[model samples]
Target chain A: MKLILLLFLGQVAPVEVRAFDTPYDAGGSITIIWEMDTAWVAKVSRIGIFRASAPGLQDSLIETLYKPDSVYVDNSAKDNVPYYYRIVVYSDDTLIAEGKTASAAVSTQQWFNGKRLSVLIILIIYTVFLLYFIMRARTNKNLYIRKIAGLEAIDEAVGRSTEMGRPIVYIMGLGYISDIPTVASLAILKRVAYKAAEYNAEVVVPCYDPIVMVAAQETVKEGFVEAGRPDLYKESDIYYLTSDQFGYAAGVDGIMMRQKPGAVFLQGYFYAESLILAETGHSIGAIQISGTTAVTQLPFFIASTDYTLIGEEMYAASAYLSRDALSLGTIKGEDYIKMILVVVILIGALMESAGIRILTDFFSIF
Target chain B: MTTIIWTWVAAFFTLAILSFLYKDNPLYKFAEHVYVGSSAAFTVLYVWVFDAYPKLVIGFKEKAGMQKYMLVIPLLLSLFIILRFIRPLSWLSRWSIAFTVGMAAGLGITGLTQGFLVPQVQASFLPLFVRGETVGQTVLLTMNNVIIVFGTIFTILYFYFSREHKGVLGVSSKVGVTILMLTFGASFGYTIMARISLLIGRIYFLLHNWLRLV
Candidate 1:
């Protein structure tokens, strides 16, 4: 039994270690190689690499390698700084063996260093413009903004549904409650529910995720409560159908067919099911307003829906719905930065076309 | 003759699908049903050949060496998934639901930590400046590396929740959020531009390739 225990320990031991020159990129990196013992082949766990400034100093754990591989490259060392490296091997819960330290000093690479100059200039310019806008917006400067037609039409959509004596259907697309896009969707939900409560119209929300269904229920309840019509909120209206993407689409299609809602609102992230849902709403002669950041689904929505909020417009919906100052400020800052970008692009293009290298050079000094 | 036949078939299917944009008619409905049926059949065949046969059945036979009995569990589980047909037995599908949810949660947590958190933290911790041979290098760090490292640190702090953002960190994080928003907006604009370009390309194709127009 003692001999068998010894054999097991030996079989699980860390493999031989060798230091090799780091290749391809630069001399700043060092590569270490090892061999895994056969007995722990499938079960052998991650390798950990530790680095130290000096031989006698305590080594700081630099990185953990999860792959069951025999090689690791330490790329964190700086130029002219003497460094020591070590590796720890593991099998399941057992630390099988640890390798000895290897020392090296990182050397500089000129070509790689020079290639990054243009990138630095671009970043600096972007950062400056971003800071400028943030400061300007903070001071509460008057900013001209165009009205978003979809946001302006929200009241009209809800009012029409109330007048027609038909329900307003709110479909939260296949996005998790935690995602920023879904948060925006919920914000819109609150607004729609509030309008529905005031107008005394039925609001129906069918969800794809259980968590989102719960959040939607809470948001709608809050909206009704805030509108002083808490009695009008129905829990059954906010319900989960299925997590399956297409299955939820089919269910919503059936709901649209049966109920014939006067207004349909599609918000949050959607995929292939977007067109099917939008087309179904269109067929029913409902006023369809859709918003999503999913670029692929945007075209289909635009072609089929009455109004479609394109990309960042969806992000701006929460602000438009709530009139939140922070969100409005962010949007204004975004516009300013966009203007700066247009100027830079035009200048860069003109300089390149005119063969004036100095303009490009001067621009690079950001 | 072969080219002509293939062109006609392609045109028919294209017209059928495109007709849905105008209104849902019988031709569009037929095309839609055909598409759905073909997709479902393809999915079943794919899962059986790629996922089920190899990963579950053959995997159990090779790795666990419990072939016949293990296969029984999966076969029953699959049948349970189809239990939606019966009203009473539908609740039996909870076993598969629980198993899938538990496994997915475990895998998602592992992937989130590995793919996002750890790498991002490590990437952010890289040194701002490295010694170079020239004075330009000493004056400024590598541009791409600087932006990546800077972006990572500020973005992380932008999501920090320990204290109210009021001081230097708050101001910096506010700036960071602005940068992030602008980048997102710019990327969105570029993406729309690319899509519009593609739409133009498709229109060009239809006019030039299908109709033989210049």
Candidate 2:
């Protein structure tokens, strides 16, 4: 019937239109796709989408899109309801040809996005690796982990401060508490605080975020408590500075100049002020140990600091320092996954070179 | 006259900050204190105007039904965080912290996986050779693809920590380090250029806008 109507309208090209529930979506949406020749596309000024509640019902023009759009998603469609759609081709605001779907499109909600199947698979495999090792860690205590110089130097940095009779300053950069790097920095700070408390030395932590300030205070207090020196923990040492980037840098530079800390730990996320802070620490004659995931700032830290934790090394600091069986196991699992990914990439590249798309097709979904 | 006065003030502050390059002086300290103090005040006002006022006060006024009532949860959470100053009620603040950490960790993992991990893996699937129209073009394309594919593989291998870097793994990781160092070198040069551009902007402001020497 749709074909007959198109023929009656003197349309030469066979009008094909489909309206269906969009896949890999949260639902209440129908996707309309139509085919048009490149030649016909030149004559089309706009395309109109018409929707009706039922077949043979008067459909209202829902949306008119510019030419070159072969697809349209109607997000306002009701779930589990059938929607009849018609595609009208217009030339200079005049309707030229139209196509209607032979069957209705129904929108329904999906529990899981099909497009994220690969991500789910990877997550499940990685989780399995973690869980297996975490459990196995109870028995297997001989996991061989490589040495990270930045983490290894923490004790030495703290000891240097103790010997010099100067406070150790730990800058948590400008990351809010929610950032992964900031959270990772908290773990490293706890270790530093513990060492400082053991040496009866002061550890000053100037925070960029208020919430991080509180967390740092608690972490320091915990470290002191663990060292059996809770009395040494000073709340004033872990304090909030301005959240403004340059303001924080200026404030920290001031602290470094006045206090003249023997050692400085620059950890977590940093921006333009990374060099300013590092350079200030250098001028103060402090031993600086820096770690961050910021690719751009790593060079500044590497250039100025005595030891630098590059990229993933910062994330692995806690696991490396603690040397807890479980943490080691997790690292082992991560390393294995990295190895697997390398293999996957190699095989993918080889296959792609040979004009095979098995792996490519599998991971092609956005 | 007002513009001139403000420009003079700005120039003085800028000069004061720059003087720190020579040594930390009283002028630098004075300028730094003013910057930090004003920044703190500005941050408080910014949060109230943009965050708390809009999300809470206006939400209570404008939002209807369930949404309006739901705002109470966030209000209570905010109070819990502020309750830390009371000492005795500091423990309550941990609840808010815990909620934020858990939510952030969960969101961070899923967000990174979807946005970074999958996209990166897909992008890395480059063909090792290309069939361009010319031999030179083909060779260039193939070389580029090989560099990308192997560069990515080796760099990833470098990050593996469970095993010691020795033998073949050591060589691969070494190559990775070399590549990473090269990248950092380029980044350093690029960032230095940006910093110089900023300095030029400040100098331009001093000369063109303030001093009017240009």
Candidate 3:
């Protein structure tokens, strides 16, 4: 704040403008700011801003602002294009003070953003824990993942199918081969397929994507080989049905009707078709176990299925079932990361309560 | 006249799907086959014409110097996808899968942090006391904020895996489950509303388009 007495003075200090590329942005934006003289600011009628794309070109008048104005952001400047800015102060159109930046401000792309430094740090910490735990697990350290009811029941579902002399139907929901949930679901299917092979119960997998069908075949075959039942593994058991959403649902529903499968496993990325599949299984009186990360489909599974794995549970199901060290270690690492987030939120709340925004401001950077 | 024919076709398929509520039948089977066959054909055509053509043919034709050479990256990646069909070369598809999955994780982390983590954390902070407000409003506002802060924290606690969920952790997880259940219930209700509205739209289509009535 400048002293109020400065308003009566003939001259105010020259406007100092600082122009730099906007942080955390893709590119092509430059933020401009000029220091304000709060006291001398009263006397100034307006300030006119001018910009030139490159040096020696005529500065185009961009904007004008009245008293109390201190900043003007020029976003029209293209990336790699040099920008020069001039700020002119006027009292009733009579120029009182003028300043122009000597150096050109050019917007450049930043691969690593300074603003997301906090998020990057948190990610690194989580990754370190994940790698360390995975290493420990690979070395045969027992990582105790909690007893997930949905996973434990997989054995019972497979056994029941075997005893009843019925086939088990596994729908690896409607996700493409590349989806994370689909990957996790495939992991769980390995365990399911192994259990089915061990018990000599037939397991049929109907896939939406052709690539997923291929992956499913490999997984089930590998599972049977691991279970020492490779001879029992049928190549045609896992097949690509259709890619159409409702058509796939109809196909699966038809299998549930005709085959009357004893056990049904629904996992991966489901959509509006989840209700159709789960509700049909319910009506068929099959022991249905459903899991997915799709929040919208959770209720249908929960309402109709015997056991439903909630969002993260669907991803963690394979690790819990197979007790793999690396996967278990990764889940533990994610837990620790969640704890860190909780701490940050608590500290932010405390700061906000005290009217101190230091912590909250840091979190808001991203 | 052309539109009328298409409308009748669409209406026929729509009714075939709706027949699913009664039982799976031959009519439903026909619609299912037609839908799958047409959609697969459409996807192949769409990918070839829109994406594959421009990225490959046009890049080679129009791209200059270093830009043209850079097309080899995508070209090689796509070749991995083609390898999936060949029995011996099938394992080579892992390269493309790894590239895609790796990119998805990297992109997901960035988006999740910016879109979910930061905004949600900032939003969780709420000032308890107002400098100049009635006591009732202050209590209500403070209570609202307190519930938001606590609910979010405890719900996240439920997902923890290192220490077995027992003792104090167990209590927190119980609360977390409650919050999660409430969220699922609300989401289910919301989805049901949207689904019902879609049903209404189909019903209107049946009444107006198929039957030609009000």
What global local distance difference test value does model 2 have?
Answer: 0.90
Measured over all alpha carbons after superposition, the RMSD of each candidate to the real structure, in angstroms, is 16.9, 2.9, 4.4
lDDT of 1 at B205: 57
Q: What would the DockQ be for model 3?
A: 0.54
What does DockQ give for each predicted structure? Answer: 0.02, 0.78, 0.54
Compose the digit string of candidate 1's lDDT tens values, residues B116-196: 433333333333444568878754655544665556555545543323466986886677776666665665566668767
lDDT of each: 0.69, 0.90, 0.84
TM-scores for the candidates: 0.46, 0.95, 0.87
Clash list (residue pairs), candidate 3: none
Worst 10 residues of 1 chain A by lDDT: A357-366
Taking chain B only, the TM-score of every model is: 0.69, 0.97, 0.92
- Indicate the residue-level lDDT of A39 in model 3: 54
lDDT (10s digit) by residue, model 1, range A1-366: 432474476743545676554543556776777775655456657788888888899988898877678887777656556677778876656776677776543444444433334444444554565566556655754433455667778889999999999999999898875555677788888999999999999999988776577678778988999899999999899986766676577667767867999999998898878878998998998998998878677767776788877666676777566655555555655555444444444454445445555445543321
Q: Model 1 fnat? A: 0.00
Give the per-residue lDDT digits (tens) of candidate 2, residues B1-214: 9999999999999999999999899999999999999999999999999999999999999999999999998898889999998999999988888888888989987788888877788788899999899999999999999999899999998999987899999999999999999899999999999999999999999999888899
Error of 2 at B70 (Å): 3.8
Candidate 2, A1-366: lDDT as tens digits: 443454467664545899999998889999999887665676778888899989889999899898668899999999999999988887676565678554799999999987788888888888899988887777877667799999999999999999999999999999988899998898899999999999999999988899999889888999999999999999999999899999999999999999999999999999999999999999999999999999999999999999999988988887887778777777878888888889999999999999998887777667
